[model samples]
Target: MRKFNLVFYFSGGGQFACEIEAEDMATAGSIAESLELRLSGCKGYDLYVKKEDK
Candidate 1:
């Protein structure tokens, strides 16, 4: 499995924030899903996952 760094930017006005680190996209998606429920009410919450470079 590949490692990835997931970044979630909450729209509004704030610095870039890292959300989670996962083994793969699937895991990252799950993490994001959980976050979405918890973070509900905040506008423009977006999730992004990118593989870590070796």
Candidate 2:
């Protein structure tokens, strides 16, 4: 699994961000989308996969 950082932006103001562990980006995006729908005034979200140290 990999670590993903998700940032959700709202139309009404404020933001929601978290770091989650997931198998892949697709799964992370799905989770983020689900959260967005559950929260009111969510405009969209950005997904970032954390880079592992060498």
Candidate 3:
């Protein structure tokens, strides 16, 4: 299994991340769902928070 870094984001604020062993990034989706976390979406690596400024 290869090491994939997954990051989960929240609408309110902040993010969560974990490194797991998986065959591919797509397969890791189930792992994220199994955790039962409130997620806007799985975002890129280190983008922890954001909102529309304009």
Candidate 4:
């Protein structure tokens, strides 16, 4: 398993961070997108995942 960091900024000009566990970075991105969709007060957001050396 690997850990990924998702960094994004919402429509209201607020930055947010999310961490997720998955077999790969692609999976982590999917998980982050799902989580983002369910949040309130988020008109839009930039999706991204960062890979770590660990």
Candidate achieving the largest lDDT: 2
Clashing pairs in 2: none
Judged by whole-model lDDT over C-alpha atoms, candidate 1 comes out at 0.58
lDDT score for residue 4 of model 4: 67
Tens-place lDDT digits, model 4, residues 1-54: 876666666666787777767887677767767877887656544444455666
Which regions of candidate 1 deviate over 4 angstroms?
Answer: 1-16, 51-54
Sort by TM-score, best first. Answer: 2, 4, 1, 3
Residue 1 displacement (Å), model 3: 0.5
Lowest-sum lDDT 10-residue window in model 4 = 42-51
TM-score of 2: 0.84
RMSD of each: 3.2, 1.4, 10.3, 2.6
**TM-score of each model, paired residue for residue:** 0.49, 0.84, 0.49, 0.63
lDDT tens readout by residue for model 3, 1-54: 656666666555668777766565555656656553444454434321222257
| Candidate 1 least-lDDT 10 residues | 40-49
